[model samples]
Target chain A: MAKKRILIAKPGLDGHDRGAKYVARALKDAGYEVIYTGIRQTPEAIVSTAIQEDVDFIGLSLLSGAHNELFPRVVELLDNKGAEDIIVFGGGVIPIDDFDYLKSKGVKAIFTPGAQIKDIIDFIELQN
Target chain B: MSLNEIIAKKFSSWEKNVLEKLLKKFPERQKEFLTASSEKVERLYLPFENEQEKYIRDLGFPGEFPFTRGIQPTMFRGRLWTMRQYAGFGTAEESNQRYKFLLSQGQTGLSIAFDLPTQIGYDSDHPMSEGEVGKVGVAIDSLKDMEILFDGIPLDKVSTSMTINAPASVLLAMYIAVGEKQGVPREKLQGTIQNDILKEYVARGTYIFPPEPSMRLITNIFEYCSGELKNFNTISISGYHIREAGSTAVQEVAFTLSNGIEYVKAAVNAGLDVDSFAGRLSFFFNAHNDLFEEVAKFRAARRIWAKIMRDKFSAKNEKSLLLRFHTQTGGSTLTAQQPDNNIVRVAIQTLAAVLGGTQSLHTNSRDEALALPTEDSVRIALRTQQIVGYESGVTNTVDPLGGSYFVESLTDSIESEAQTYISKIESLGGMISAIEKGFIQKEIQDSAYKYQKDIESNERIVVGVNKFSVEEKPPKGLLRVDPKLRDLQIKKTTEVKKNRNNEKVKKNLSALKVASSDPNANLMPFIVDAVKEYATLGEICSVLRETFGEYKENIVL
Candidate 1:
C-alpha cells in the first residue's frame, strides 16, 4: 500500500508541541508522509491545510486546556468543507471526561500523555 | 606498585573473572549504558576517571571566582532555597486568594501564572479569549486587575516572580504601577518578570513580536531596570521550558547559556555596560528524574556561565559572574496513570535541585498531569521542597556531590558537550539567528523524538507508564476551573472600561505609540504611564502590534 499521508497540526494558542512533533516524527519513521503545522494554528488554517494537502489523517494536538473548544472546531470545519471522511485524532493533556465527547464529534481516538506511538500506529493501520 | 597501577591490575583481574562470569550468566542489558543525552556511562567511575590535578581549578570554592561549587559560601546553611510555588488561575481576586493561601502555608516567594489571554495580551472580553479567560492562569486586563492581584501582598516585603513573556512589558508596567500604589518605589521592587522572549520562540511559544523587535524590547527592559529597579531581575533566560520541551540536560544548559550570551551582546550593543545589566540576569532550569545528571547539569551551568561572564563579556562585578537559578521539577515527568507516583517523582527531582545548590525551587504537584493542581496537591508540592530543605540533611553541605567521580566526570562531559553546542550556535550567528534558521528547534525536536522512541521501545522505564502498569480508577481532587470565570472576568473588563478615564487612556496609549517608533526611546516609562491610566493589556499591545507588527511563527519540524 502507498504510504499514508498524515497532517499533524496544533490548532490552538497552546505552544506545547512536544507531543505533536514527536508523533509526527514517529509516523514519518513508520513510513507516513507527515505534514506538521507548528504551534498556534487556528481551526480554519488546520482545515484548509488538511483540504489543500488532501491528507488521509489529521492529528490535532493541544495542551492549554483549550482542546475542548479548539479540537472540535477543526473537525466541525472539516465537516463543513465536506471532508468528514478524513480521520481525525486528538492528543495532549486531555482529561478523560472529554474522551467520549471528542470521539462523538468525529475525533477517532484520543491519545493522552505517555501514550505509545506504536498504539497510535496500530490504530491508524487498523483504520485501513 | 603505584596506586594507579595496582588499581588497574585489580580492575583488570575482576573484569576478566567476575564480569565474564556475570555476563555469561546474564548478558548485559545493552552494549553500554547511556544517559538520556546519549553520553556513555561507565559501570564504575573511579577517582582517576577525571584528571586529579585539575580538581582545584574545576571545583572552586563556593562564593569565589569561577563558582563551580555553589554561588554562596554557606549555601542553604545560611538560608533555605525559596519555596516559590508557581500558582495562578481564574480572576485576579481568585488567584490573589491562592497566593495568600500559599504564603500562609509557608511559601517563601510568590510566582504568578497569568492566564492564556493575559499572557497573549488579550482582554478578557476579546473574542479570541473566549473560553480561555482565566483557564491556564490568572487574568489581568489592566492596572485594576493588577491592583486586585496584589491587594494585600506587600510588594517590598515579598519576592514575586511573574511567569509572563511576549507582553512582558505591559505586565511589568502593571506590576510597577501596583508597587507604586503600595507606596513602594521602583528600586524597592524585588522580583523577576520572565521577560525572556528568545526561549518563547525556541521552546514555550508565547512570542508576540518578531525577533529583532523582541530583542529591542528586551534591551529596553535591561536599560530601564538597571537604572530604576536595582533589586529586580530584568530577565530570566530560561532552559526550564526547553528541557520540558524535550531537550537533553546538556542542550538545556547550552541553549540557555547561548541565550544569556545573546542577551548580553544585545544589551552591550545597545550601549549598556555589561556589568550593570548582567548582575540582574537570572536563569531558570527544569529538574528532571536523573539525579546525578541534573546535579551535574547545574554545576556545569554555573562553571560555563562564570567563564562566559569573565572571559567573554568581561564582566567585572562578582554578582554578574554568578549564575543564580530557580528550578521547577519537571512537569512532563508527571504521569496520569498512577497519580500518586508523581509525589515520589517530585521528591526525587526536588532533592536533586536542593543538592545541586539551587537558589530557589518549585515542586510539581502530583495532580498537575490531569489538571491544575488543587490546594491539597499544591500544598504537597510545596511540602516536598520543605522536607528536602529542612529534613533532608543534604542542605547542610555545599555541593556535597562535588567530588563524586561519577558526578565530576559527568559534569565535565556535560560542560564540554554544551560548549560544542554553544560554539555551533555562535557559528550560526547567535541564538536569534539560530532560532530564526530553526537550528535550535530542530535539535530539540530530534532529541524529543529519540526520547519518546526509547520510552516506546521499553529501553527507558517510566514507572506506571511502560513498566509497572496499573489499572486504576481515574484520579480525583484535580482543580476544576469554573467556566463562569470567563463571564465574571468579561464583566469586570467591561466595568473597568466604563469607569476608567477614557481620554487619559487614549493620550497615554498614543504617547506609547510615539515612543515605540523611536529606536532610542525607552518604552518602559511610556508603558508604565499607559498602565497607570488603566489602559488594558490588549489595547497597549494592539498599539504595539500596529507599530511593530505581531510575530507570525515559522513552522519547522
Candidate 2:
C-alpha cells in the first residue's frame, strides 16, 4: 500500500511555526509522507501545489484569528476544481460554537487549542 | 460536551478491550485509582476550598488593590486596545510598503518581524542568510534596512516594536539612528525591542552568547534606555513563543513570569533603579484558545507582577506595579487542513485578547497557517480587532467578567498552581539555571507529551480531528513569498556595504568588540556608534560572537 501523502501549509501573518512544524513531525512519525509548505502561502498557490503534489489530505493551521475567511476560500477553491473528494481537515483556536457551522460548510474536522497529536493521527487514519 | 460523554466517546473502545477485560477477569478487590482528571471532570480545576488563599491577598481590582482583574481599570473603554498586527517580509522596501499599508488600515502601532539572519544578527548578504534571506520576515542588514523600514513613518509619532533577540542591542542602535534620521530626539523615540534572549533559548531556539554575556547585553540596553529613551520599552519579556511551544496556560504563565523576575533582578543588581526600568518593562503573551484559561492566565500574570514589584523589589510607584503587555493570538493553534477555518479561530483568539485586558493586540491572519499574510488577509485581521473594539460591548465594564464566579475562581486556581511552579524552579535554582538544566524545558516537554498522549490514547477528541470526520477534502490557500526576495535583499545589502565607508565601518566594529569583551563594558554606546557609521548587522554580530562565545544548546531532545 502507498503511504498517505499530506500537506501542512501555514497561510497567514503568523510566523510561529512550532505547532504546524510539530504536527508535520507527528504525522511523519505516524508513517505519512508529510510536506510542509513553509510560512506565508496563498490560497491559489496552496490548491495548485496540493494538486501537483497529489496529496491525500491537506492540514491548515492558523493561530491568527483569521480562520473564518481563509478557511472558506480554501474549501471553495477545491470545490471549483471538482477535487473536493480528497480528505481535508483543519485545527486551531476554533471555538466550540463554530464547529457546527464549519461542519455544515463541509469542513471535515477542527482541532482546537490543546488538541492532542495522537488524536489528530487517529482522526487522519480513520478518515483515510 | 459533558465530561462523561467526552470521556466515553474517546475511551469507550479502549476501556472495553483492556480495562473491562481486566475488571471481569479480576473482580476480587477494587483498587482506588485517582488521576489528574478522571471521567468525572475533563479538567480538574482548583477546588473552592483553596479560594481564600489564592484570591484574598493576590487578586484584587482592575487597576488598584492587587490589580488582578487587569492592570488598567477602564481597559478597552478608556481607549480601544492598540491594534498592532505584526508585519514584515521580503526586502526592506517591500516591508516598508507593507508597514505603510498596515498603518493606513487603522493599525495603532507597528510590530516588525525580522528574518532569521537578522534575528541572529546576520546581514542579508551573509552566506548563512542565503536563500532564507527575506523568506520569513524583512531582511535587515545595515542602517539602510532600518532606514527603509521606517522611511516615511515618523518614529516619534508611531510606536514601533521589533521582534529581534540575540542582536537586540545592535538592532536598538539601528532604531535609535533611524529616529535621528527622522529628526526625532533620542528621548522622544518610542517602541520596543524584544531583547528577551533568555526565552529565545528555552522556547524559540534563537540565542547568540552564553547566558552571562547575554544578560550583560540586555542589562546594557536596560541601563541605556532608562537614561535616553524615556518612554520606550527596552525588552518585551515574552510568553508568546513559550506558549507556542506547547505549554499549557499554567506552564506558560509560570515560565514567563519567572523569566521576568530574572530580568528584574538583573536590572536591580546592575544598580539601576527598579522604578526607572521596571515601568518600561513590557510583556508579550500568546492569546491561545481555552478562553477561560487564557483570560485567567492574564489575570494571574498581572497579580503576580504587581506583588513581585511592590513586595520583592520594593517598587514605590504604581507604574512599576503595572504589567502592560502586547498579545498576539496563538499561532501554534492553526492547522494546514481546511484552511478557511482559521479565520474563525483567529477571531475567537482576538476576542480572548480583548477580554483578557491586553494593552495592545495583534490578530494573526488566517493565511498565517500557510504563509505570510497578503494585503487582503492582513486587512481582515486588522478588521477583527476593529469589530471587537467597536461592536463588542464587553469593554463597557472594567474586567467585564471579573466578578464571575467561574472566571474569578479560575484566576485564583491558576495563580496558585503557577506559584507551585515558581517554587519548584526556585528550589532548583534560578530561571537561567532552570533553563540550562532543562528543568523548565522538561516541564514544557512533559506537558506537551502528556497532551499528545491524551489525544493518541483516545482520551481527548479534537472536533474535526478525532470525532467529526469529513469525507471530502477542502481546497487549500497558501501564501508564497516571491522567491526573488532573497536575491533582492542580498543585492541591496551588498550595495549598502559597498556604498558605506569601509574604513569607518572597520574602525567602529573593532571598537564595538573591544568594548563588549570587557566585563564591565556597556555595549549600547559602541553599538550606537557602529549603527551611526553604517556597520552591517553581520559585522556587529560577528564581533560579538568573537568576543563572547556563541551559546550551545544543551537540551537532550
Candidate 3:
C-alpha cells in the first residue's frame, strides 16, 4: 500500500511547536510521510502546501487561542479550492467548547492536549 | 579499614543479603526507576566518607561565597518568595481589571504576559496580527495602551515583571514613561524585563532581529540600565522556556547558564564593567514533577553560577555571585484529561519550588493546558503558593534539604553534568554559535521525542494520560478572547497615530533608524524617544527590521 501522506502545520503567530513537532515525528515513525510547516504560517500558505504536497491529511496545530479563526480558515480555503477531500484535523491548547463548532466546520478530529500519539494514529488509520 | 571502605562493604552486603532476598519474593514494581528527565534513580544514596574539608569548600553557609545551601542567611524566614502570577489576556482595559483583581487577592507581584504580535514587535493592527490580538496576553501598541495597562497602580509600590523580548527596550521605555507620569523617577522603578533573546532563538520563537543586532540591543540595555534604571533587572536569562520546549533539568541549567555567559561576554566586550551589570542579572527556571531532581537543579544552578562569576569572570561584588531566580511550575506537565488533577500537580510543583529556595514563583493554573486560566483557577494557583509559604513548615529553616545525602549527591551530579554541557557549548564558540549550528535545538528535540515515546510506550506515566485512565466530559468555562478585540485595538492604534504629532513621530523614528545603523551607538535613548512620541510598535519595529533585518530560524526538526 502507498504510504498515507500528512502535513503537520502551525498556523498563526504562536511558536509553541512542541506538540506539533512531537506529533509530526510520531506520524513519521508510524510509517506516514509527514511534511511539517514551521511556526507562524498563514492559512493560505498551509492550503498551498497541502495541495502542492498532495497530502491526504492536514494536521493543524495552534496554541495562541486563534484556533477558532485560523483552523476554520484553513478548512474553508481547502473547500474553496475544491480540495475538501483533503482531511483537516487540529490540535493544541483548544478548549473543548470549541470542538463541536470546529468539527462542524469540517475539522475531522480535534485533538486537545494530553492526546496520545496512538489516538491520533488510530484516528488517521480509521479514516482509511 | 577506612570509613569509605567500611561503608562500601556494608552497602554491598546489605544489597546482597536483604535486597536480593526481598526482591525474590516481592519483586519491584518496575525493572528500573527514572525521573521525569529520564535520569536513573538510584536504589540508595549513602554518605560518602568525605573529610570536613570538602564540606567547607563545596557546601558553605547561606549568604556566603559559593552559596550552595541558599542565597540568603534567613532564606524564607526573612521573606517568603513573591507569588507573581503570570496573567494577561484580551485588551489592555480587560487585562488591567485582571491585574487589579490579582492585586486585591494578595498577589505580591505582577508578571505581564504580552500577546504574540507584541512579543514579535508587531502592533495590534498589523496584517500579520489578524486573529491574534490579545489572545495569549495583553496587547499594547503604544504609550497610550501602556498608560491604561498600569492606570491607578502606583509604579513604585509593586514590582512588575514584563515578559517582553526583542522589543524589550521599547516596552521598558514605556514603563519608565508610565513611572514618570506617576511622579516616580526611573531609578525608583522596580521590575524586570525578560530581555533574554538567545533563549528565544533556541526555545521560544519570539525573536525578531538577527543575532548580531539582538546581542547589541541586549548589551545596550545592560549599559543603559546600569547608569539609569539601577534597580531594574536588565535581563532575566531564562531556562523556563527551554525546559518547556522539552530539555532535561541538566540541559535547562547548562543552556541557560551558557546563554548568561554569552551575555556577560558581550557586555564586557562592549566595554562595560562586569560587576556594574552582573549584579542585576537574574534567572528564571521551571519546576517539574520530580521533586528531588528539580530541587537539586535549582541548588546546582546557584553553585555553578557563583563559581562562574568568581572564577570565570572575576566578578568583585558579592551581589554579582548570587543567583537570584524566579520559578514557574511546569506548563507541559499539566494534563488536559482530568483538569482538576492539575491542582494537585501544581501543588507538588509549588512545594518543589519553595523547597528549592526560589526568590519568587508562578504557579500554573489547572486549566492552562486547555485555555487561558479562569479566575477561580488562577486564585487556586496563587493559594497553592501561599499555603506552601505560610502553612508548610518547610520555610522555617534555610536550605532545609542541604545535608541530605540523596539531595547533595544529586546536586553534585546535576552540577557536573550541566558543566559538561556548558563546556561543550563553550568549545563550540559559546551559545550563539551553538544555537546557529542547531546543536542546542537538536538536543532539546531529541529529548522531547524520547519523552513522548516513553509516555506512548507506557514506560513513563502521566496521570490521566498514560495511566489511571478515566472517562470524563469536556472541560467548561475555558476563557475565550473576544473576536472583536482585534478591531478595538486596531481602532485605538489608528486613533493614536491620527492624534499624535506626526512630524515628531517621524523624526524620532528616523533618529532610531540612524542610531540602529551605527555599530557603536546605544539604541535605548532613541527607542525611548520614539516610544514617547506615540510611535506604534509595528512602525518602530519596521524601521529596525529594515535596518537590522529579521532573524531566520534554523528549523532542526
Listed in order, each prediction's TM-score against the native is: 0.97, 0.77, 0.98
- Model 3 lDDT tens row, B516-551: 999999999998999888998888889999999999
Per-residue lDDT of model 2, residues B1-557, tens digit only: 86556655657676678778987878733243212212121222323434456556666657785788788767666898888978888777888999899988889899998877788777766554544567667888889888988899988889989898889998899998988887899999889899998887767766778998999999999999889999899999999888877678888888888998999898789888998889999999998766766787898888888888898899998999988999999876665455556778888888888888999999888766555777888898889888888888877878776656667766777788888998888887889999889887666656665665666675654555555646535333445456567677777777887888889888988888789768788889999998888888888899999989888765433
lDDT of model 2, residue B243: 80
Leading candidate by lDDT:
3
Q: Distance (Å) between predicted and true CA of B461, model 1?
A: 1.0
Off by over 4 Å in 1: A1-3, B1-6, B13-29, B49-52
Per-residue error for B45 in candidate 3, Å, reads 0.8
lDDT of candidates 1 onward, in order: 0.90, 0.78, 0.93
Q: Which pairs clash in model 3?
A: none
Q: Per-residue alpha-carbon lDDT of model 3 for A15-86, expressed as tens digits? A: 998999999988998899999998888999999999999999999999899988999999999999999999
Off by over 4 Å in 2: A1-128, B1-59, B469-477
Candidates ranked by lDDT: 3, 1, 2
Deviation of model 2 at B35, angstroms? 15
Off by over 4 Å in 3: none
Q: What are the C-alpha RMSDs, in order, of all predicted structures?
A: 1.7, 11.3, 1.2
Lowest summed lDDT over 10 consecutive residues: which window, candidate 1 chain B?
Answer: B47-56
